[model samples]
Target: MPVQVSPERFDEIVGEALDLIPEELAARMENVAVLTADAPSPTQRRGRTGRSLLGLYEGVNLTRRSPVRYSAVMPDRITIFRLSHCRIVRDEDELRRRVARTVAHEIAHHFGISDDRLRELGAY
Candidate 1:
């Protein structure tokens, strides 16, 4: 059975997962906001299996930015889908692991790491 949690508890888990990031990396993360949603919005679903989207990073990545061109932009958003995660995990422990992995994966995007590269590094 899928593990379920209150929104507050889920947010706590997300925070815990974020804390797993290395301090050096965390320090370099700028103009980014970490958020949690019960589920991805319809536009966010974007033809993918909605439940498959554990998290999303929406913004220009660091590597693609230029000091001159990158200015006056809203903060990047990294959204963790709480319900989607809850629908897939078997227990709280598994949920934590999954959330941690998803959080790392999304943060990697902020650092200009692509999913393909992450796969190459066995990060998946």
Candidate 2:
């Protein structure tokens, strides 16, 4: 069965996961906003129907930025799908680990790491 948690508690878990990030990396994470949502919206889902997304990172990654062209842009968005996480875990410990892993995964995108690279690194 899915282990459910209150939204407030879930938010706390996300915060805790973020806090675990190294300070140097966190400091370099400029103009990014991390958010939590119940689930991804339909548009966000696009045409993928077979899998549920645990998180999403939307915006230009560090490697794609140029000092002249990157000015005055909107903040990068990293959204954690709270409901998806809650639906997959069996208990609080699993939930915490999953959330932490998801957060790290999304943050890696911000730093210009691809899913393929993550898999190569045994991070996935």
Candidate 3:
């Protein structure tokens, strides 16, 4: 069954997860915005009706950005889906763990890491 968590609590959990990232990596993140959504949008669903998307990183990745054009670009976005994450966890502790994992996974995408590579690293 899906666990119930208040919106404020869920946001708190997400914040805590972001805090867990290593300082060296976190410090290197530039022009990035980490956000939370209740759930993935229909368009974001991409026809995967039953699958849960824990998080999504949108915008150009670090490695793909041209140095000359990077200065005026908007911040990259990392959105963590609260409802989808909460639905899969058993309790607060599990939610926390999952949030941390999801945050790391999304941040990896920001750094230009592909899902295939993340899976090989056991981070997917």
**Top-lDDT structure, candidate number:** 2
Worst 10 residues of 1 by lDDT: 43-52
What tens-digit string does per-residue lDDT give for candidate 2 at 1-124?
Answer: 9988988999999999999999999999989999999999987788767777999999999999999979999999999998999889999999999999999999999999999999999998
Q: What RMSD value applies to candidate 3? A: 1.5
Q: How many backbone clashes does candidate 3 have?
A: 0
Q: Model 1: per-residue lDDT, tens digit, 1-124? A: 9898999999999999999999999999988999999988988888786237899999999898888978999999999999889989899999999999999999999999998999999997
lDDT of each: 0.93, 0.94, 0.89
Residue-level lDDT of model 3, residues 1-124, one tens digit each, is 7788988898899899999999999998989999998988877778666577888998888898887877787798999998998889888899999999999999999999999999899875
- Cα error, residue 104 of model 2, in Å, equals 0.3
- Estimated TM-score per prediction? 0.95, 0.96, 0.92
| Residue 85 CA displacement from its true place in model 3, Å | 0.8
In angstroms, the error of model 1 at 19 is: 0.8
Residue 73's lDDT within candidate 3 is 75
